[model samples]
Target chain A: MPTIVVDVMPKPEILDPQGKAIAGALPRLGFTGFASVRQGRRFELTVDGEVTEDVLAQARKAAEELLSNPVIEDVVNVAVLTESAQNESQSA
Target chain B: MTAQNTELPLIGDYSTAGPVLTGARIGVVTFPGTLDDRDAARAVRLAGGEAVPLWHAEPDGAAALSSLDAVIIPGGFSYGDYLRAGAIARFAPLMDAIIAAAGGTAGNDAGLGGSAAGLPVLGICNGFQILTESHLLPGSMIKNESLKFLCQDQVLRVENNATAWTREFSAGEEITVPLKNQDGQYVADEKTLDRLEGEGLVTFRYVGGNPNGSRRDIAGITNAAGNVVGLMPHPEHAVEPGFGPDSAAGMRLGTDGLGIFTSVVASIAGGAQ
Candidate 1:
């Protein structure tokens, strides 16, 4: 089996209410450090077989169909890697 | 022990304690600025639903499991309130799982299919901010018309009172609750606002006055299906009658907040699936 991964996010243009809220609250908490907090989802999948983009696509399709709202949230970036490759990137 | 499940003792049975929330599995997602996760969980238990806490970074969304019946995105600052309120939270590991489970496969059912059917999702304050950012709700919350951080006990008129979360509220009934946010103003295009008003999509409205200058004095709104609800007021803060906001009539109201959680129980048990 191949591993499947899915990432979710609001279309870039769609304004993030939660992000704005935290942005507004940070100064009050005296912990304003970062510039922005763009909220989105990241999904990781691992299968028994090769983790091909095609397999990942299936998961993406499932996410688009059921998981994400294209009108407001959009899928931006995606990448597929073997367990070793994923580990390499993580270690690096 | 939840009010549902029927496993909990009805009247009194000291020897055999009941489940915490019975079997009403409820989920609470924590974003970076989320400050009310614990309060939300306690409110769920008071209303008889098991609270499942979800995190922004924790992967393996599989933990949501089939046992869950509803989910609550508690209020707080997620991701240090960087760009927008709920913007960063929308990308949390748990959101992907929720989106997949509830969004469902394209052809299956418009609503969440499979085990997520009748899954009631509620967003409060920052949670409400997340719902809009996540596209779970329409319209948006902007800077207060006054551009000031607003915190007050406000009165609101329950508008539709027909959602999975607001079923317990009487339509048009006025209730007081806390409103705290810098950007609580709700706005939308004329058409969308008109449709929302005409379609009875407005859930609750600011009672005495518009706290943050929301469109049409709107405090909350629900989806067409009524399973998903987003609001600016902190219903979770006013569960017990006396402990909650002052009831309209001035009685020793402890927890009106239970109604929100109880509404979830009603939605799952008596939803139009």
Candidate 2:
């Protein structure tokens, strides 16, 4: 089985209050490395069969139409998960 | 004038001596998490129209909409506000039918009738979210600037009274209705906002104060053809006296929201005539 990952983020022009709240909390917790933060969503779609160009295309379509709204958010990344990367994620 | 001397008309008052005009059949859609369909139906009935129940997952979308004089997408947390406020419900089969009938694109093809006005559709609250998600209306609803789920009686000034759902209101008339939602902030690009303002498509503007940080204090808007209207407030909740918000008339006596329901019924009846 394979997996397709879709990453969506709020548009730069849009206000991200949730992200800002998280960023504020991080500084209070003594982790002062990051200046700002923006929250986003990630979706992992499991494929039953082998990943192909057609599957990737379908994932991209879903990302644009369902996973993210073009008005306030941008579909930043849509890609297939490699076997090694999947293993690494599972182990971690 | 004293309360007793005032001649304010009671809400949902219809003369029994004359024949009731229940000819217009309006459909109220119920998505999985819809909470206001019953209220919407009651508003339609009070407005002298028959209310038809519509399911979001209706297999035969065309059949569900065929006999309806108008359709209302009421407010609710459809699909439990998953992904986004209305992202999932926007793809429902019934919404596809509504999109087609509203002269909006559904799935890739141009709208059914090629931008010509079709059915009259009103989206309230969550329904407004779905309309934007479906591209029937422009812009998107994000979390409120306050980052809280607000519930209150809101004041709105009608800017465009020619829309199907606002025919009973005069331009610049102020109305009071309930507004409750988490994702109610409306946003759009500057060009789109300018065009809406320029074309007089802005149907309602927040009057007293901005409730949710909506762009330009716009509380409602209508499509170019004026057949499709979307608003953040819940008019259905204020259609009946004693159940509505307080106003100068008396406590819980405000029926300003009834005008929206009656407007559509009158529009449909007038068209038939």
Q: Which candidate leads the pack in DockQ?
A: 2
Clashes per candidate, residues 3 or more apart or on different chains: 60, 0
Model 1, CA-based lDDT: 0.70
Q: Look at candidate 2 and tell me the lDDT of residue B118.
A: 71
The deviation in Å at residue B190 for candidate 1 is 1.3
Evaluated at residue B73, the lDDT of candidate 1 is 84
What is the per-residue lDDT of model 1 for residues B177-256, given as tens digits with 9 covering 90 to 100?
Answer: 67788868787767889999899999988876677768799889988877778888888888766666666556546355
State the displacement of the C-alpha of residue A20, model 1, in Å, after optimal TM-score superposition.
18
Model 2 lDDT tens row, B1-273:
334224322111112213346688888888888888878888888888887778787777777787788999989999999999989999887787888877776732633333244788999999999999998899999999888999999999999999899999998899999999999999999999999999999999998889899999999999998999999999998988899999898998888999999999998988822
Q: Candidate 1: where is the Cα deviation over 4 Å? A: A1-92, B1-21, B62-65, B104-118, B248-254, B271-273
Q: Once model 2 is optimally superposed onto the true structure by TM-score, how far is the C-alpha of residue B267 displaced, in angstroms?
A: 0.5
Scored against the true structure, residue B3 in model 2 reaches a CA lDDT of 47
The parts of candidate 2 lying over 4 Å away from their true place are B1-20, B107-117
